[model samples]
Target: MLKYKILWFLFNLKASLASYRHEVHELGFQKGKKHLKVERIGYLPQQVNESSGLVYLAQDSTLLTHNDSGGAPYIYQIDLSGKLLNTYPISQAKNVDWEDISADEQGNLYIGDIGNNSHQRRDLCIYQVNKKIDAVLQKIPIHYPEKQTVPDAEAMFVAQGSIYVFTKNLDKSGTDLFVRKIGDNADTLQFKSHINLRTPITGAAINPQKNKFVLISYGKIYYFRIIEHQIDFSNPLYCLNFPHKQTESIAFLDENVVIITNEQGEIYRVCEN
Candidate 1:
């Protein structure tokens, strides 16, 4: 426990320094009005103490989330009010280090077992499950480019039949974006681009419209405009700062409203002010 505490402290220190550098150097372009209204909605069930991934299922009007690393191989279904509605167990999957969850337009859900904190994991993969969440459809193995050290990642989303992954970038001020088609076979993740956000991205979500996306960090929310279905990293719509702790997952309630969850099982809602 003490080791973890020390590691956490160091991580925060590095993140703070990176943010400071970005502000001091004016590294990127952020436009429009600032500030967001954040409200603590409720707390998740005790059983889901380490909620790491979140996705809104509009079909059932419920939210789905899973544990961080080794808790269980089950997904918990809850409502906007934080009430536990049901639990769906992925009978043939292992939790390993489930970091994020995303869904394609067909209602097919994907689980990212891609957490590589030690930067030495080689069996990283994403699990594709049916919308019913009862069975594993496919295990899509993921790998970094040859000779590239693995980095920890917690943010991922699926859009237009493609999966987008953003690395945590704990040691630097930038995150790399990797892309791969939904049904692609086991192969290396293609390095698409990089963004110097000066903070580790913990969660990601594409709004209902598919023209905009948001990435969440410990104390910041980054809104980006997706032009021509391509993520525009050069300009950010909003970089709203807020007070949050260990925020690990995010999902769009709508195009403007977002729901956030932390490791402590607390839920919060953020909307444009």
Candidate 2:
């Protein structure tokens, strides 16, 4: 009987140790520690001199991008190799400072025309269009509450049925974040929070499945986790610096894969191993 009791004790001890080890592995993930690297994958077409924003279409394995204010009012379709496949023209909308493009899961694309460089534009809006066509469905007008001076922003993304804009504050203050419901009829957009990223943010993207969002500046990328519908800026989960001349756009190919583009038409792929 004593021999059987001893064997049972040994088995229970081994099980406990295994469970402890499993928990340690999970903790590492929660801390956002991982091996990752960024490499130049391709170059954009020479025509896309200022590739401002990028959105990946997983349904067809293609990318939709556009230039900034001075370019034509058209969307360029490209592949992973930066090869221009097609162009869709939005005749109804003017390309007045189109800084970012975001696509929802429901085949709708949102074009942000909210660039206020001089801080004097009272006509800030986002154009919603069909993903497969060149038709502008509707225009969502935005207003900064209690202030006539609107902030200049170049990065916007759609997630969880809401649109968010991150500012590129030149005043050296922290960046301001704004949120608006998808279909709400509010004249003034709701202010959510602020992120103290001192550098000017040029682009943003989200990895939905992993609950992670990335922000890009001139030569640096910042990662943050989304918690309770707000950006958790306690500290950046990860930060990376790469050789980018003028990085302006970012997109997620998957939870671990990221694609970035620069104003000079260079494309890079960042992967986590």
Candidate 3:
């Protein structure tokens, strides 16, 4: 049984017409259209960008943990069945600014609290959380920029034990990214290297097997072919029409398929065929 709110959202999102490209026009996409090979499994939804939502890929389980980016300071963790698991509060959780979470192989989680719209922040933070989810208040510590502040990043990806932050607001000065290596759980992650996109970046994705990486920006998703010694980011193997909506989250189900969910609860599966 679906909640009234979830059902209403699905009904409204699916009302939008099915088109490879959508105009500025507005339509609630109807669910019956695209042969949704994926299921509505669960939702970690935020009201617009007021909070963050997370869902595990293994099962349709959703963790209703949203950062209190406005009213409270708790990260409410819910099971995929939408059951409230636990609430971890952080005095550092900012209002309407906390973006997303990324996890490494060690079960450690990174909370990105750098969604600055004014682009004035000198230090961007990627908060670190121990693999033990129930770890307690103050169990996690946040790291911010020591010199330059990079803002408007809604995307984070884990690679080689480091957290990579991508900026949605690519400015003329050329957008740069951050690399932070995790240590002792709470110790300041060592800043490794900055990868200059030379252009603004929008989204990021790593394959399920942790073998490949893809970035979405300038209205396209480009794949990165990785070798032992070099990573080729020259071009995407194949590209699909960027969704009608400005997509935010990218989660891979396997090597050949991915489920890109829009903020409005619309999920699109990019099949590699």
lDDT tens string, model 1, 151-260? 88989999988888999887655888888887777478888888877677889999999988998887667888788878646546776664467788999988888999
Candidate 3 weakest lDDT stretch, 10 residues: 23-32
What alpha-carbon RMSD in Å does predicted model 3 have with respect to the real structure?
8.9
TM-score (all chains, Cα) for each model = 0.91, 0.84, 0.61
Across 92-118, the per-residue lDDT of candidate 3 in tens digits comes to 544445666656666566666666656
Arranged by lDDT, best first: 1, 2, 3
Q: lDDT per residue, candidate 2, 1-273, as tens digits?
A: 347324533443333233222223422222222456778888899778889999999988888899988688899999999999998999999988999999887989999998887888889999999967579999999787877578888899998888888988755476788888888988687788776554567788888574888887674567776766565454356656544666779999989888999877889988877
- The candidate, 2 or 3, that scores higher on TM-score is 2
Candidate 2 displacement at residue 219 in angstroms: 2.3
Q: Which residue segments of model 3 deviate by more than 4 Å? A: 1-92, 136-151, 172-175, 184-200, 229-235
Model 2 scores worst on lDDT over the 10 consecutive residues at: 23-32
Each candidate structure's count of clashing pairs: 0, 0, 13
Can you list the residue pairs that collide in candidate 2? none
User: After superposition on all CA atoms, what RMSD does each candidate show versus the true structure?
Assistant: 2.4, 16.0, 8.9
* Candidate 2 overall lDDT versus native: 0.77
For residue 150, give model 3's deviation from the true position in Å: 3.9
Whole-model lDDT per candidate: 0.83, 0.77, 0.49
Model 2: what TM-score? 0.84
Ranking by TM-score: 1, 2, 3
